[model samples]
Structures are given as structure tokens and as C-alpha cells.
Target: MYQKSLVELAADLQKGAYSSEELTRACLQRIHTHDERLNSFVTVTETQALTAAQAADAAIKAGTAGPLTGIPFAHKDIFCTNGVKTSCGSRMLDNFIAPYDATVTQKLLAAGAVMVGKTNMDEFAMGSSNETSFYGPVRNPWDETTVPGGSSGGSAAAVAARLVPVSTGTDTGGSIRQPAALCGVTGLKPTYGRVSRYGMIAFASSLDQGGPFARSAEDAAVLLGAMAGFDARDSTSVDRPVDDYVAQLNQPLQGLKIGLPKEYFGAGLDTAVGDAIAVAIEEFRKLGATVTEITLPNTHLSVPAYYVVAPAECSSNLSRFDGVRFGHRAANAQDLQDLYTRSRGEGFGSEVKRRILVGTYALSAGYYDAYYLKAQQVRHLIRDDFLQAFAQVDVIMGPTAPSVAFKLGEKADDPVSMYLSDIYTISVNLAGLPAISIPAGFSNGLPIGLQVIGNYFAEARLLNIGHRYQQVSDWHTRSPQGFE
Candidate 1:
């Protein structure tokens, strides 16, 4: 019962196979049994969850429930949940309870989904691995010694461990996809502006978009449908009509054209991951989809360009944490500068601080043109490359990460190495394209993910592709042993 996909669970609830309270209790029980070592959750709202579940069960009995009614899901700590401590995985917001709900959270509740807990994340959503989280790193369920990719690591870990069937994750430069790949789940980073950013903690505001993590592409589609839409509170939110994502999940892939980027298969990519993605492409061909080799020449510059753009925006957005309006404040400061320095120094983790410094330097007066402005120009080139490729292919395919989950501390000491883990994913964000990571295969007992990149607002097509693959393979349904 615990292993059921969210879609199956929702159906079961609708048929009275089980009440929402029973399902919620089972999930809470699973979290209690497994979360101690996983450290996936920062807070578990047992009472609130049960209350919500009971209401969902009553609604279903009354024939008034929505698709997600009685379904349990977790939220990344960065999303502001009313009356809950929306820490954003930083000590600065440790004691800060939000005054209101984030647009995403509010929408999920409206859909009758039960909020089980808040998952841990990288401080200010700033790191590639969960190691930078103030709550401590989220260990990959595949192997306890490996780090789940971040800043959505905890969300991925929770889903992977069956603590929840689905969860919300915010991606800024690969946070959601990378972790989902490592943890063996499906994650979608929707086209920028497709989802509202209102009440979500800022982290490279231009790049951060909240999406869903789930066991299957169809489930992700349902969650995405619920979470997406225009919100007047977020100026960047797109006013486009939301599509019926689940309705398109069964679309045939017979005439689909998938482009395999040459740059993504070159040096630095792990052989195991490469082989797995190659096999997935072959599987796509078997599904009657056409595969073609394409080139995105500027792909090599993605990391450097992302480093400049993400950090510069981050530095500007993060300036609000200067011991002024909200978050942590320093005690007994002699002067204003001391207060600012000490508060930040005490609140942020090492990676967050490093990014702040790098961002500050890049955005500084003398260096803005050399770094920030130049990266913006390079970003346009990357976007142009994708636009050109999409004219020839229906969707793009590649390995989500260069490799499988690495040991927890493997890249912690080297920030540059950590940044490269996001090489494939950062480009998607830069282009503001929709991309998803689905469990493709495993190597040495660790999961590898196959990424599907689509044109702007092409989430439904990506989901169709993923759903077709999932129908033929059980990779996405396979979970790490001993966790359940």
C-alpha cells in the first residue's frame, strides 16, 4: 500500500479502498520508522496532517474531493507555509514562522493534498549537494554514504524512501533534477514563470521555479497541474492558461523527434551514466520515436555562465537578510556594519557565504561588465542554441547529471567540482525551458537519470515521453532496498 504511486493512491481513496486518514497515518508511520537516519524532514505536522486527511476523507465521501484529495506530500523548507516554520534551511530563518502560505502551498491545500512535513534543503537553496543544509546533509537512500543531490535533496530523499508519494521542490540551477536523479525519482523543473514564486524564499529569483517530485511522470503531471497557474502576487507569473497535464500523459510518441546533444556526451561524463542514457535513447527508438544527434556548441560555457548569472542575482536578492527587516539579527552589535556582518556570518553556511562573496564580486561596479553582463550575453547564445535545436527535434535528451550519486563529502571541499554536477541542468534554467529527470537505469547499485528537455511550456510533451518510457520499463518504480 505504501509503495503505490500517488495516482493509484488517489484512485484508491476515491473508491473507498482506504480513507485519507489511514493513508496519512501510514505515511506518518513510515516517516517515523525511517526518517531518523534519513533526516529528510525538518518538521512533521502530524496533527495538522491528520486533520487535513480527515477533511479530505469527508470530502471524498461527500463526492466533493479533487484529484489530489487525501494524498500526502511534503514541501521543501523554502516554501512559506502559514503557521509553520519556513526555515529555507538556514539558521537565519530558523525561528521565523511565515505569516502566510506560499502560492504553491495554498494551491496544494486547495487540491486537498495533505502536508505531512517540511523537508530540509541547501541553505538559501545555494548548494549542489545537501551538505550545505543547516539541518545536516540528506543521505541518498540508495547508499547511506552518498549525498542526495541538492538543494531539493531532502524532498527527493523523502519521496525515494516512501515517506511521501510526492513533494514540492524549487530548482535554481539543477537543485530539483540533480537530486531526483541521485535519489531515483522523477522531478520536473517547469518553464520559468509557469509556476508562481509568490511567498517562496528567493534564491537567484530569475532561476528559481517550483515544481514536483514524484515516483512517476504521470503523478508529476498531476502535481504540476495543481501547482501551476497565474498568481497576481508574482509579477513574473505567466498569465497563460494551464493545460490538462494528466489528460496528455497517454499521448503517443510515434512521431516524436528526440535530439541527443553531442556536447553532453563528451568528456567529463561518467561512462555508466552515458551508457544508461544511450540505452534510454535506444528504448525511445524502440517506442517508434526518431532519434537524431545535435550540437549545442555553447554548452561548455553553461557552468561558467550559470555561476556568474545565478550568483549575481543571488547576491542582489539575498541582500534582504542584512539584519534589517526579517530573519536573524546579531546580538549586542556595536555598529550597523558590525550587525550586518555578524548576523550574516552567524546565519549562513559556508557554501552560502562563498556564493554571496562570488556574487557580490561579480555584481560589483568595476566587474559587472566582465562577469555579469558577459554571462547574460552567453546565456542568450545558449538559449539560441536550444531554439535552433528544437526547430529540428521535438525534445532533447541527455544524462541529467554527469554521474550517479557520489559520496557525501566527495565534492564538498571543491566548489568548482560541485558546480559541474549541474552542468547539464543549468543550461535548461538559463534557457527558461521545461526539463525533467526520470530514473533511467542504475549503475553500481546507484540510480542514473535520463533528462528530457522541451521547448517553452512543453511540459505535457515531456510528461508524455516519460510516461511512455515508464510504461515499458520499471526503472522509475524500483526503489532502494531495505528502506521500506
Candidate 2:
């Protein structure tokens, strides 16, 4: 029952093979059994999930349930669920319980999806590996010592371990795709503003967009359909009509032109992972995609530019966490300065502080133009490079990360090395395009992911491409051995 995709589970639900209560129970049981090792969930809403499952069961009996009725899924802890602890993997928010549901959460609940739990993430979505998380790092199910790539690490780990069929994740810079790559799952980062951000705890607001993680592209499409749409609450939410994502799953990719960015394939990418991506591209060629080498000239500037831009935005967005408003406050304080200093100094993790410092420096008066404004100009160039490449190709493909999962503490000492893990993914956020990462194959026993990047609002095409690849391969279907 746990092995089935969300689409299959939904079909079985409609066919009366199992009740929502039973499905929810199965997921809860799995979490109870396996989450001790993976540490994927921050808070398991067992009572709320059971109650919602019962309601879904009632709706099913009444013949009014939607397509996703009774299907179980989890949300990354960044999303604010009314009365649930919406910790963004930070000590500051450790005791915070939101009074409102994120727009995405509201829509999914309305579509009858059951909430299994809230998954773990990096502190304020700052790091590549899950090590920055205040709850502790999430272990890759593939190998217990290996890290599940992060901010969305818990979401990918949960889905990959089959604790849940699909889960929600937000990507500021590769938070969704990179973790999906390491955990061997499917994750999508929809076009910026396509999915409403209301009530999703802000982290680099302009770049943070939430989407779904699932075992297959079809399941992702189903989840995306329910999660996306215009939300007046989120001023940036595009008012365009939402498409039936699942309806477009069967679209073929014949004659599609896939661009392989020259810079992505050059030095620094691990050979084993590169080989796996090459094979995946070859398979696409066999399926009738025309492959061409393209150049995203500004690729090298992406990481530096992202560091400057993302942190600058993060510094501003995270400022709202001052003890007076909400979240953790110091137990003892002589005055406002003491309160702010003690609260923040104790609340944030090392990496979070490091970024806050970097961001504060870049956004400061004298450094503003040199760092922030310059980074913004470079960001424009990066986007322009993609625009140029897309003019001649239907989609771009690359390895989601340089390599597969690394040991838990492997890069923790070096922040720059950790930042580089997002080299291939940050550009997509910088460009504000749609991208998806699917388990392509494995290298040295760890999962590797193939990144499918589409033009603006090209989620349908990316999903179709991913669906085609998944239809021909079983890599996405393979689970971590012990978990099954």
C-alpha cells in the first residue's frame, strides 16, 4: 500500500480498495517506525491527520470527495498551518504555532489531501545539506551516513522512504531539487509566483516558491494542480488561470530540443553523476529528443550573485522575527537592546548567523551598491543568458548537483563548499523559471538526479519530459532498501 504513487492511491481510494483512515494509519505507522532513524518530521500531527482522514472517509462515502481525497502528504515545516508548529528549522521559531494556514495548505486540504506531518528543513532555508537544521540533519535513506540534500531534505527523505506518497517543499535556491536528487525522489519548483506564498514563512521572499515532491511525475502533477493558483493574499501570485496539470501528463516529448549547458558539463561535476546524467540524456535521445550543447555564459557568477542577493533579502525578511512581535524571546533582558541581542544570538544556528552577518554587511549603506546592486545586475545577466538559450531550445537538462549524497559532516566546516552544492540549481531561481528534478540513476550507490529546466511557465513541458523518462525507467521507483 505504501509503495503506490499518490495517483494510484487516489484511484484505489475512489475504487474503495482502502479507506482514508486506513491510509493515514499506514503512513503514521511508517513514520512511527522509520522517522526515528531519518528524523524527517518535526511534528507528526497524528490526531489532526486521523481526524482529517475520517472527514475524507465521510466525504468519500457521500460521493463528494475530490480526486486527491484521502491521499496522505506532508508539508515542509516552513509552511504555516493554523495551530501547528510552523518552525522553519530555527530555534527562534521552535515554539511558534501559526494561527493561519498557508494558501497552499488550505488548497490541498480543500482538495481532500490528508496531512501526515510537517517535515524538517534547513534553518531559514539557508543551507544545501540538512546539517544546518536546528532539529538535526536528516539522513539519506539510501545510506544512513549520507546526508539528504536540504532545506527540503525532510520532505524528499519522507517521500523517498515512502512514509508519505507526496510532500510540499519550498525552493529559494535548490532547496527542493537538490534534496530530491540526493534522496531519489521527484520534486518540482514551479515558476515564481505561480504558487501562492501566503503564510509560508518568508526566506528570501522573491525567490522562495513552494511546490510538491512525489515518487513520480504524475503524482507531482496531481499535487501541483491542487497547490497552485492565484491567491490575492500573496501580492506576487500570478493571476493567470491554473491549468489541469494532471491532464497534461500524457503529452509526448518527440522532436523536443533539450539544451545541455556547456558550463554545467565542464569541470567540477563528479564523473559518476555526470555519466548517469549523460545516460539519461541518451535515453531521452532514444525517445526522440534532439540534444544540443548550449552555453549559459554567466553560470560561474550564479553562486556569488545568489549569495549576495538571497542573503540580502533574507536579512530583511528575517528581521520581523524580533522578540517583541512573535517567536522566541529572551527569558531575561534589561532593555530592548539586551532583548534583541540575547533572543537572536541564542535563537539562530551558526550558519544562519553567518548568513545574517553576510546579508547585513551587503545591505549596509556603504556596501549596498558594491554587493547588493552589483549582484542584482549579475542576476539580470544570468536570466538574460537563460532567455537567450531558451530562444533555441525547448528545455535544459543537467545534473541536479555535482554529486550524490555526501557524509553528514563532510562539508559542514566549509560554508563555501556547501554553497557550491547548489551551483546548478541557483540559476533557475535567479532566472525565475520552472524546474524539476527526477531520480535519473545512481552513482557509487547514492542516487543521482536529472534536472529538467523549462522556460517561464513551462511546468507542463518539464512534467511531460519527466513523465516520459519515468515511464521508461524504474530509478524513480526504487526505494532505499531497509525502509521498504
Candidate 3:
């Protein structure tokens, strides 16, 4: 049951091949038996999951079920779940049970999906590796010593390990796509404002977008269909009608125009990963798609610009979590100011503190124009680069990460090197465009992801492209050895 794709599982449930309760039990059992090895889950709601599964079974019997009914999936810890510990992988919120559901949580629940657990992630979504998580790192199922990528690493690792067929993740700076590449899964980061961000703990409010992780593009499409829509409460959410992501999954790619950026294939990309991407391109060509070379000139400035912009937003959004309100509070203090100092000092991890400090400094009055304003200017250039490329091509293709998963501590001490892990992805967020990462191939047994970027609100087109490639490829279907 765990081996089946989400689409397959949904069909099985609808056909009465297996009850939702039975599948949910199998998933829970797998988590208990193997998750300690991966540290993927921060919380497992066995009682609630079983109860939800029973409700789903009743819905199906009453012939009132949706596509995701009875499906068991995990939520990234960053999304608040009512009555569940929505610890954003930070000690500050370790004991904070959410009083309400995030918009993503509400939508999934309405779709009849059962939440099995909340997956671990980087503390405050600040780090490139899962090592910054307060609960400890989430191990890559493909290679335990290597990172699964962050801040959505746990969600990616859980799906890769088959602990769940599908799960939710938030990508602020390649969190969903990078980990998906390392874990050999299909992940999508929808256009900004395409998915509601309400109730999702903010990292970089502008860049943080909730998405899905699954074994195939088809599964991602199904999840996206349920997860996306206009939300009146979320001001950032676009007031646009949602596309039928699943309905377009099988659209032909015969005339697809794929643009391969010269920068993406240049220095820094792993040789094996580049070669894998080359082969994947040929596969698309065989499917009758035309490939062309393109340039995103401002791509070189993406990393630096992202650091400044993302941190600036993070600093502002995280200000609400002071000692006075909910979350962690200092045990005792000499005064109110001291309480604020101690609470934040003791609550946030080193990486989180580093980002917050940098953010604060960038947004400081005297330095605002020099750093924050300039970064925003560079961000515009990056967005323009993508706009120009999109004008010439239907979609842009590249390696999701410059390399395969690195050893867990390889870049932990070197923050610059860690930031570069998202070099290929940050530009999309800057442009607020839709993108998808699918398994391209592996490099020395580790997986590589082929990123597909489309114009804003082109999620359906992006998923259709991914689904077409998946039809001819088996990379997404392969599982980590022990888990299989």
C-alpha cells in the first residue's frame, strides 16, 4: 500500500480494494517502525488519523467523496494544524499547539485527506540543510549521511521513504524542489499567491508558498487541485479562479518549447547531473518537444539578492513571536526588555538568529537603501530575465540544485556555500512563477532533479509538462533500497 503512488492509492480506495483505515494503519505502522532512522516526523496523530479515515470510509460509502478522500498525508511543520503541535522545527514553538488550521490544512481537510503527522524542517525555515531543525536533522533516505535538503526536508524524506504517498511542503528558497531532487520525488512550487499562505508560519512572507511532494507529477496535480484556490482571508492570495491541474496532466507535449538556460549548464553544475539533464532533454525531444538555448543574465545575482530580500521579510514577520504573547517565554527576567532578550536568545537556533540579525541589519534605517532596496532592485532584474526567457520559450529547464545531496555537515559551517544550494531556484520565487521538480536521474546513486519553470499562474502547464515526462521515465518510481 505504501509503495503505491497517490493517484493509484486514491483509485484503490475508491474501488474498495482496501479501506482507508487499513491504508492509514499501514502508513502509521511504517512511521513507527522506520521513522526513527530518518527523523522525518515531529508528531504522529494516530488517533486523529484513524478517526479521519473512518469518516472518509463513511463518505465513500455514502458516495460523496472527492479525489483525495481517505488519503493519508503529512503536513510540513510550518503549517499550523488545529489541536496539533505546529512546531516550525524551532524550540520557540515546540510546545505551541495551533489553535486553528492553516489555509492549506483547511483545504486538505475539506478534501477529506487524513493528516498522519507533521514533518520536521529547518528552524524557522532559515537553513538549506535540515540540520538547523530543533528536533534534529532529517536524514536523506537515499543516503543517510547526505542531507535531504531543507527547510522542507522532512516532508521530502517522508514521501521518499514511502512513509506517506504524498505530503505538503513550503518553498521559500527551493526548500520543496531541492529536497525533492535529493529524495527522488516530484515536488511543485506553485506561482506566488496561487496558493493561500494564511496560517502557514512566515519565513519570507513573499517567497513562502505551500506546495506538494509526491512520487509522480500526477499525484502532485491531484494534490494541487485540492490545495489551491482563492482565499478571502489571505490578502496575498490571488483573486483568480483555480485551474483543474489534474485534468491537464495528460496534455500532449508534442509542440512544447523547452528553453535550456546557458547559465544552468555552466560551471558549478555536477558533471553527472548535467549529463543526466542532457539525457532528460533528449527524452523530451523524442516526445516531439523542441529545445533551444536561452539566457537569464541576472541569474548570477539571484543568490545574493535572495539572501537580502528573504531575510528582510523574515525579520519583519517573525517579530510577532516575542515573549509577551504565545510561544516560548523566558522563565524569569529582571525586566520586560530582559525578558524579550532572553526569550529570543534561548528560543531561536543559531541559523535562525543569524538570518534574523542579517535581516534586521538589511532593513535598518541607515542601511535600508544600501542593502534592502538594492536587493529588491536586483530582484526586479532577475524577474525581468525570466520574463524575457518566457517570452521566447514556453518553459525554462535546468538542474534544480547545482549538485546532488551533500553530506549533512559538509556546508554547515560555511553559510555562503549552503546558500548557493538554491542558486537555480530563488529566481522563480523572485518572479512569482510556477515551477516543478521531477526526478531526472541519479549521480553515483543519488538523485538529481530537472526543474521546469513556467510563467505566473502556469501551474497547469508546468504539471502537464512534468506528467508527460514521467510517462516516459521511471526515475520518480524508483524507491530508496531499505524502504522498498
Candidate 4:
């Protein structure tokens, strides 16, 4: 049951092989039995999950079950779930209970999926490592000593650990894919605006997009279908028809043109990780994909550009958290200003503060044109590079992260190193393209990911190509030793 994918679980439910209650209970039992060491979940809604499961069972018996009916999963803490804590993995919102469900939450619930709980994440989705999380860093299920990539590390860890079949995640830069790469799970970051962001705690609104963490590309397609679609409530949400991602999973990859950016294989990428990606691409070749060497000349500037744009946006988005409103408030305030200062200072963790300060500085007077404006220009160049590459190829592929997961505190003190962890992923956010990180192979006992990037709104092709590659390779099937 734990090893089953969401699609497989859905089939079981449809076949009446097991009740939703049984599957939900099994997942809750697994969380209770093992979550202490992983620290993956911030809150587990056992009662609500059971109630939802019972309803799903009834729906199935009444012959009204959808593809996602009775599929149990967890939400990233950032998504607001009515009557449940949506902490965003920050002390500032630790006591916050959302009054309404996020669009993603509402959509998933409408499809009859059962929510297990909300998982831990980097504070306000700011850090590269899960270490910055208020709860605690999520340990990589593959190797407990190493960190799971953040800020979606907890979701990745939970899926990798078989605590959940698939879990919701948000990608700002590489939050979803980085952690998925490190934890050896299949993670997708949809094209910006492909999914509605309403009720999802803003973390650099322009860069953040919600997707899912799953054990396989097939499972990813199933979850992505249910999570995507337009909601008029979010101004950024595109009014495009959602693709039936699952129906296209078996599409052959013959004659598919794949671009391999020469810049990505340069100095920073780990040799073993690079070698693993090479082997994976070779498998894609066997699946009839034609790989070509290309240059994303502006790749070098992505990190610096992302630092400016993301922080500037984050600074603006987070301004609403002042003590006068909802969320944590300081008790010993001498005045309104004191309340705002102390509440924010005491509420947010170090990484969030660092980003907020950096963001504020970038958005400050005089520096705006020099920093933020120049970064936007660099962002345009990055997008142009992807556009040019796409002119010759259907999708671009590369190592998702420079290396595999590092030890928990290895780069904690060195913020630059931590930021560089997302070097490969941030560019996609800048370009607002859809990208996915699927398990390619392992390096030094840790997982390596081969990222598949597609043009805007090309999620179906991305998932299709990934699913085809997965058919020939079993990397996504490999589970952490103890968890299996």
C-alpha cells in the first residue's frame, strides 16, 4: 500500500479492492510510526482526513468517483486549508489558521482527494536547505544525515519516505524540483500562471507556482491534472484550458528534439551528478530523443538576477504581515511601530529576514534602477535564451542541482553556497517556463535529477517526455532502504 502510486491507489479504490478509510488510516499510521525522525509534517488532520475518506468511499459506492477520488495526499504548509494551520513553515504564522481553502486545496477536495496534513517547509519558502524551517530541517529519506532540498523538502521527503503518494509543493526558483532531486522523487514546477496562486502564501509572487511531489512521472501527471486550472480570483492565473496530463503520458518520444545547454555542464556541476544525467539522457536517446548541444549564454547571470527580482517581489508580498493584522503579534509592544518591528523580528527566521532585507534594499530608492531594473533585463535575456533553444528543440534537459543533497549544516553559514544550490532551477522561474525534476540516478548514495524544461504551458509534453523516459528507466521506482 505504501509503495503504490496515486494512480495505482486510485485504481484500487475504483476497483473496490480497499476502502478509502483503509488507505487513509494506513497513511496516518505510517506518519505516526515514523514521522518523528523525519519531521516532515507540521500538522496532521487525522479527523478531517478520516471524514473525507469516508465521504470519498461513499462517492465511489454511489458511482460518482473521479480519477482522483479517495487518493490521499498532503498539502505544503503554504497552501491555506480552511480550519487548519497554514504555517508556511514560519514562526510568524505558527498560530495562524486559515479561514478559507486555497484554490489548489479547493480543487483537490472537489476531485475527492483526501488531505493527510500540512508538511514542513523552509520559512516562508526562502531557504535552499530545509534547515531554515521553523519546525526543523527535513532529513533526506535516502540518507538521514543529509538535508532534503528546500523549501519543499518536507513534501519531497514525505513522498520519498512513502508517507504520502504525492504531496503539494510550491516552486520559487527550485523549491519543488531541488528537494525532489535531493530526495529522489519526481517533482514538477508548472509554467507560471498555469496554476492559480490564490490562498498560497506569497513567496516572491512572480516566481512562486504550486505543483506536486510524487514518486513517479505517472503519479505526477495524475496529481498535476487535478491541481492545475484557472481561477479568476488570482490575477496571475491564466485563463487557459487545463490539459488532461494523464491521457498523454504514453505519448511516444520519437523524433523529439532535446536541447542540452553546454553552460549547465560547466565548472559548478558535480562530476558524478553530471555523469548520472549523461546516462539518463542516453536512456532518453534510446527512447528516440535527439539530443543537441546548445548554449544558454545568459545562464551565468541567472543567480544574480534571481536574487534581485525574487527578493524585490518577496519584499512587496510580505509587507502584509505587519503586526496590526493577522499572524503572530508581540505582547510587549510600546507602540504600533514597536509591535511591527518586534513581531516581524521575533516571528521570522534568519533566512526570511535576510531575503526581506535584501529585497528591501533592492526595492529602495535610487537602488531600484541600478539593481532591480538591471536584473529584469537579465531576466529577459534568460527567457530569450530559452526561447531560442526551444526554436530548435522541444525541451531542454540538464542536472537539476549542481550536486546531490549536502549534509544539514554544510552550507548553512555560507549563504552564497546555499543560494547557488538553486543555480540550475532559478533560471526556469525567471523565464516562467514549466520544468520538472525526475530521478535520473544516484550519486554517492544520494539521488541525482535530470531536469526537463519545456516552453510556457507545455506541462503535458514535459510530463509525457518524463513518463516515456521513466518507462525505460527505474530510477523513480527506487525507494530509500528503510522506507520501502
lDDT (tens digit, per residue) of candidate 4 on 1-484: 9998888899999999999999999999999988888999999999999999999999999999998899889899999999999999999999999999999999999999999999999999998889999898888988899999999988999999999999999999999999999999999999999889999999888889999899988899989998999899999999999998989999989999999999999998999999999999898888888999999999999999999998899888888888777999999899989998999998999988988999999989999999999999999999999999999999999999999999989999998889999999999999999999999999888999999999999999999988888888898998888864
Q: For candidate 4, give the lDDT.
A: 0.93
Tens digit per residue, CA lDDT, model 2, 299-417: 99999999999989988888887799889999879999999988998889999888889999999989999999999999999999999999999999999999999999999999999
**Backbone clash total, candidate 3:** 0
RMSD of 2: 0.7
Model 3 worst lDDT run, 10 consecutive residues: 317-326
User: In model 2, which range of ten residues has the least summed lDDT?
Assistant: 244-253
Model 1 poorest ten-residue lDDT run: 475-484
lDDT of 3 by residue, 1-484 (tens): 8899887888999999999999999999999999999999999999999999999999999999999999999999999999999999999998899999999999999899999999999998888789999999999999999999998999999999999999999999898999999899999999999889999999898898999999999999999988999998889999999998899988999989999999998989999999999999999999999999999998989999999999899889888888887899999699988998899898999998888899999999899999999999999899989888989999999999999999989999999999999999988888888899999999888999999999989999989999999989999989999975
Give per-residue CA lDDT, model 1, range 1-484, as digits (tens): 8899998998999999999999999999999999988899989999999999999999999999988999999999999999999999999999888999999999999999999999999898988889988899988999999989999999999999888999999998999999999999999999999999999999988788999999999999999999999999998999999989999999888989999999999999999999999999999999999999999999999999999998888888888998887889999999999999999999888888888899999989899999999999999999999999999999999999999999989999999999999999999999999999999999999999999999999999998889999999999989888876
Off by over 4 Å in 4: none
**Pairs clashing in candidate 1?**
none
TM, every model: 0.99, 0.99, 0.99, 0.99
Q: Give the TM-score of candidate 1.
A: 0.99
Error of 2 at 100 (Å): 0.7
Clashing residue pairs, backbone N/CA/C < 3 A, model 4: none
